[model samples]
Target: MGLTDTPPPHVPSWVVPASGALLITGAISWDMCYVLMSIRSHRTKSYGMPLLALALNLSWELIYAARVAEHPLERLGFLVWLLLDVPLVYTTLKNAKHEWRHSPLVAENIGAVLTAMVALGCAANYAVADWWLSAPGTGFGDKSGKWWAGREGFDCTELAFWTAGLAQLALGTGCLAMLLVRGHSGGTSYAIWFCRALGTLTGWIGSTSLLWWYWPEAHGFFVNPMGIFLMTTCLACDTAYPFTLAVVRRSERVLSDGRLVSGISVKQSAAPIVKKRL
Candidate 1:
């Protein structure tokens, strides 16, 4: 009997022992809150885009995790995500223009290209990467054969991963640049600026991971997990900007309403006194 005949041991890592599970669960909960809040307020603008990104991220994460768990059909779900990501990447990039209108020509184009490349490469890599079943202890080993894990499966996969990282960096860098420009222009909100800054830091981590991928010795087992977590946090923070802004706007509206009500009450109280005195 071959080791591949049985399920692999469930060894976990400290970097994110249950991160895959948490990410899947947390994203759903957060997105549900976002949707409920948006619906209750009847405010659709700026909210839907972030929510959409979160949805896509969660969906792909689920597929990836399932594959790790050795689910046969999960590979098909990944392919589906790869296809769906094309339009999603476009949407994310398009929205950046509005968010960072003050961004320079280079920054703006970088953001656009980065979004597109990441989407394309991520989809392509999962579709073609041979490591899916070839790696030691993978459950798919039993069902998969050497034919499916040939050298061709390894071909340019690293390139695809690097391309995805570059795209993420470009978008994150652009967002940070836009925030700086906003600060200089005195027009950007603090929450949005903070989000971009967080993204920039995570983007750096992801970029570093790519650099590590090129070198065999420096590839710490934790590198991939750390990089993945950082990027996910970055994206989650970015998507949260809209919700933060919405909460601020809601607060301002409530304050305005209170002031108006007070003013009306004061005028009515004074009017009766004046009429009686006259």
Candidate 2:
């Protein structure tokens, strides 16, 4: 059934607006982390978000904003996200060459490569959304043989929520892995990670609660094996990220000259070595 066709899920009057506020706050918080990361990258000349994650995130926002027009508030939220992504994407591309200097070819072609990846990601997102809307049992199709072209069957709210959750999981894991491999928080701070984790948690709760209250019949999706696994894995990674950053920071060495070094050899002259003069 279309969104307008079905009355909103019955719940306490306060639930809908409260959940919406939470969702909007989560979106703002998440984008703010990217803003901070972009600023860090500008200062450090190191890219924060992994290329794959950036592509997926940008594409998700663009595709969702374009396809999900039924809900004005939610569509506006997506548009706001797209606007926030502009600076993040710019900083990422600007620092790409410096961040991946090991491969000159990639550094030179980073912009083109990322653009292509985003195009592919948009296509993939569209395909997934279409499948979710038209698929049997899960989709909005009636048993009657006639296919309605302009009519919508599935709820865009649920579709957007699940798609965004999955995308966030992927992006979060990729970012965490990149930070670990670098062994230094060059373009990301603990604050960014903390905000991201909090935002994801809040968004998850808001979106899931709304769905549960409105579409009680589909509540099983939240408790399904795959759903549980995804949620657990995302939360586990987010929770451990702070410790990972802390460990990385501790492992870093500060030279006598006040320069920080990670996984790199420091000369005795550069680092203070206490010597006994007999």
Candidate 3:
């Protein structure tokens, strides 16, 4: 909470007060999303977070915590996220084979795939961070953590726009695809979706917009066409997801092997529709 010895002259007094509140609210919501996903995965014996999305998330936390983030609070948050991902990742890998029945090659080699994805994710993160910090006009070392900008530069705000935006796209879109393929909400819940959707709204969209309002010159990119497209796509997917869940829930059937699948069972089938919903 210490102010910069030399603050950005253009920064308004209210920036911190407004942004900090949004940051805390978004942080709590995202943290709860992960915690709820972990509990749901264990209860239903299924994995949450699509496979590639899991790899991207785990590696993002690891790379940021270990190398990229400088602020002690930022590093601590990344570390906590990595720790929470452990059980969620483990359960997903353990139970993934059941869902991959149509693709034996993938089912047999998912662990290797995940390992490769994590390696790639780490490399991608490092490369992006290095490029962002090394660019001629952009590398100011995050002065905005305490101020606003450095010598009229972006102050690393673009990194979050790209990196965290990518994560949101992967998670929001991938989750819906997973639900469609599985035809059940075994590893997902309204709580998880609610927290995730709300977190992104408050954390990225709301707070970033507030910053834009105060500093248009450097922060205007957030409301431009490209940024608007990205944010709109994410919100659309999340909004559509819960309705999809509602439709899929009506005919949810339990398989003979104890896994939940979509569709009502036949008269001769051993599986039956599960009346209770999560």
* TM-scores of all predicted structures: 0.33, 0.80, 0.85
Candidate 2 lDDT tens digits, 88-136: 8887777777667678988999999999999999999999877766743
- Which residue pairs collide in model 2, if any? none
Model 3, 70: alpha-carbon shift in Å?
Answer: 1.8
Q: Over the stretch 122-189, how does candidate 3's per-residue lDDT look in tens digits?
A: 99988887776664346323434433223333354556666778888898899999898788988888
Cα distance off (Å), candidate 1, residue 176: 5.5
Best of the candidates, lDDT: 3
Q: Which segments of model 1 are wrong by more than 4 Å? A: 1-23, 29-116, 135-178, 181-220, 223-278
Q: On a 0 to 1 TM-score scale, where does candidate 3 land against the true structure?
A: 0.85
**Candidate 2: worst 10 consecutive residues by lDDT?**
139-148
Model 1: how far is 180 from its true place, Å? Answer: 3.9
Flag the better candidate by TM-score, 2 or 3.
3
Name the runs in model 3 displaced over 4 angstroms: 1-10, 139-154, 255-258, 264-278
Each prediction's RMSD over C-alphas, in Å, is 15.1, 7.9, 7.5
